[model samples]
Target: MNNQHDPLSSRPLVSSQEYSEVKNEDFEETACEDSITQRSPSTELPAYKLRRSAWYPDMRVMISREVLAVHLVWLLILAATIYVLGRFTPEVKCGVSRLPSDVVFGDIPYQIVNWDEDSGFVNSDPLDGKRWNQSREWADSTDWTPWDDIHPGSWVQVAPSSKLGISGGIPLRDYSKDGSWDTNDEGYALTMHHQIHCLGLMKHVFISAERNEPIPSTSFRHMDHCVEYIRQSIMCYGDLTLEPLQLGSSQKAIESDTWGSKHFCRDWTALKEAVWERSTVGFDRHGFVFDKVIP
Candidate 1:
């Protein structure tokens, strides 16, 4: 028989030469309890490759769980603080670099209001005589309008954030010439209010073949002042919109119609809301809000 084929048997095998060289003492332990597997007090596992997250660096010194958690929390706090300062803080710069990037105020701080029939500003479809109904203190109803309020002094409110152009508010012009913020003479007024008064003054002087109405003989100076003022205002907001000159019967074909000309405008609605919200009714000597209207 071949020795190679004989070695394939299931039984344990030892070479005769190696067995002859071994001493009997090598297998000396024979106690029943000792025959079973024994143990040392402690054992060590093989070293393994550790994985650290890309976020945390592998400092050679071990970082404790509590310290690592504190570091993570601190990082989160810093991130939040940066976010808040960037988000809520208002911008100080003006002219295109304002807080609200979308809102453009190339002209004046104004809220866009459509002067359709509802406004009574342009189209005559809007009815008048409703001021008394909505007024703060015109209940008894002698019937008042901006036109009526021009001569008599009145009160007005102002608080300037210096955010837009207007300072806390425009100084209350002593319209009574007495100058009070809507004191005993009348109630609140604004630039538009003053503009209306000027318009009323000029309206009294304007006369035409349209019909019969007494033309007040107020000084031509007041009339001229208003006329020039209105003229200057029209020129100031020079509508740069290209009103293409068209040929007409008249030689000066400077015929420009602004019936439907559209221009970039400020959020007039937002401005009005802000005005009403910030407008203080009255204030004391120390500039605190109260019942007494400041003179």
Candidate 2:
């Protein structure tokens, strides 16, 4: 019989080549599917070829590192700026001095006593009375008003000696040939009054006991006391300094006494001007005129 027609030959043995090819194809397809399943989302595409919407596997760590570097650089810059400012900026402490118990009067120093008491009774004599009368007459004859009429307060006393008169003593011809107290004297008096007011001390209005003549020792002592009180007030109210306050050339007139004589009034005015100038600067820096009470 022909082998092709034989039933036994109809189910010929399957070729080993065909079986091997089928098995190989199946194995390759399974390997491909396993590789796709095991891959992370980030690594599915090449880093450079990945779409803008896709995330890079290592980009997260790199971006975090870049951000951290930027923050560190900013922090370093801020620290450097603070250091520069602290190193270069100047420090200024504005303050004042204390009042001493004793102050200089005329050429000699005297102790301050009875600060609350009136200075009117310190030294009164027959000559002082005559001088006082003369001063009153001078004030009445001229346009000047009486001290009591001008300043009405317990701190102020109306006495012949306290009257505003010409620069000369009683006779008037001794100092000023014409019996006239110029604006200089008025300025001095005004300065004295303001200083006393600033001190907030005894209210006696007569800053100078001997109004028309040179200051006497007792009167000078009183004047010195007032000056000390003013100095102390300035210290308490504003910044203190060994150097005088400079208000520039515009305020030069305040520094100098345009009034003829070199008296306690002139000296006191100088002190006042100094304190005012310093207080102005303090105000500009600190935003306050005075730091403490006047007293």
Candidate 3:
């Protein structure tokens, strides 16, 4: 090293007091900068940097208060959307996903029924307990019940059915103890049962005619109601199967036969399943509908 005339060897190139002042100023500036950096990276911005990070934004810097507020609002909106979808919409099952909708109703299927008019149900003797046994599904009303108990209504008339249920699948009742009000009991019979009951009445009337006995006034009333009911049911069922008039053994024009009449029909099974699921009180003969849903 050149020791002579060197700045280090000679009196300082700059005065000691000046150097100390500069050094002190440099040290103070560096310390101030370090403190500012610890508090925040930006000077113009507020000292709002947080130690903890937002769950969504894992950046080293804190999220703005306005931004955090917006995120909370968005989350609330999402929750509300989910709630609305679940509340107002009707839940209909569609594969893995259930669709909620009032416009989409359930399905009712169909089947073919080959009517057997020659069957024992009608062809047998009315007095042989054959014609009337059909109505016996409900508690025996053979001069027992005071009024009609198998059915439910203010009116004792207007209904019947078939391929539907044993007794139109209606819940039966014991009318034996009832006076004016309808009483429900064991056994199930639908509207068709009522029609069958009417037929049974007609059968008794037929036996009376055969024996030359006077028909009861009630029997006449029942016969009239039954005739009207059957006529209306035919209109309602709308069995459009074409039945051409037939010719008798004498080659004369004879009435068409109902035997083996193939009818394109609503599938009782599918409709039955849907009915039970939706029915307030069903084949089990219990309860009525509540809140428009089967409980």
Candidate 4:
């Protein structure tokens, strides 16, 4: 072909190898662009661009403190609520709800009688000398008095023989083998009597045992003396109504007669009625109602 007139020679002539190399270079550039476009945003983005301004160390610390403070405030509020509820709640009272079936002994309410002038124990040492001698002799004697003929003062006559039984003798003498006086034994007896007297006085008076106040030894002794007087009267009169006797100058003796005559002797039937009235017939949640019955 003539170079000046040929159509293929009109444009710049390229080698076959050069054209192939140019096509391959263009394909390589396209593949590099596609790989860059497909890469993850995290790997492609700058560190500054990926992190927010609010997520800086100082800002993060401030946010954590605020969250912690909110939790602490809520915890404090909950604790305070619990404390208030505990402080204001009413206390619950516990006790037995039922009455007892056993016979309950209680102190009979009696007025104090002032008969100090006529007490039989006044200036008389019943524990020693002539009285002691007589008592000792009487204890050995075999003379017996019928229960029907017994009177208020008759306890003195029957006490010697009755002492052989469980209930009649002074606790100290009864506990001793030779009937010797023991201060400790006497104290123990008095303590027992005091307990019994307190039970009698408080019987059926309180709905719950926890509500009852402790009885003082002095008060127990006073009540015991009064009951002892009544016991003597019961022993003597055998339910007979007798005039109140002058028991002597001792306050115990005088008070005994005063209270005993009014409660035990003068109105013996009434006393029995009172006991019946005070007794309960139902089952008890607590233990026995009374420790002992005086009569």
TM-scores of all models?
A: 0.37, 0.20, 0.37, 0.19
lDDT of candidate 1 over 1-295, digit per residue (tens): 2223346786444333322221234223322222243322222211221122222444533467668889999999999987665444445444333332112212235443333232333222111222212233333345444432222222345433333333342445443234544532223445444555566545434432133655445546777877787787768567555544555668666665544555556565554454444343432232111123444
Error of 2 at 119 (Å): 14
Candidate 2's error at 234, in angstroms? 5.6
Give a tens-digit lDDT track for model 2, residues 1-295. 2223446666444322222221334234433444434332331343343343244535787999999999999999999987664433432223211111001111122232222323343332322221122333332323322332212111111112221222321221222323342212110123334453333222232433345544546654666777777887667556321333345578654353222332211243344343332221111111111211110
Q: How far is candidate 1 from the true structure (C-alpha RMSD, Å)?
A: 16.9
The residue ranges of model 3 lying beyond 4 angstroms of the native Cα positions read 1-109, 125-189, 266-295
26 Cα displacement, candidate 2 (Å): 25
lDDT of 4 by residue, 132-221 (tens): 122344432243222111111111101222212213323333333344433322111222233333433333123223457565566556
RMSD in Å for model 4:
27.8
Query: Deviation in angstroms for 142 in model 3?
Result: 15
Q: How does model 3 fare in lDDT?
A: 0.44
Give the poorly placed runs of model 2, Cα more than 4 Å off.
1-55, 90-295
Mark the regions of model 1 whose C-alpha exceeds 4 Å error after superposition.
Answer: 1-155, 159-189, 207-209, 247-254, 278-295
Give the clash count for each candidate: 10, 7, 14, 10
Question: Where does candidate 4 have its weakest 10-residue lDDT segment?
Answer: 148-157
**Candidate 1 global TM-score:** 0.37
lDDT of 4: 0.35
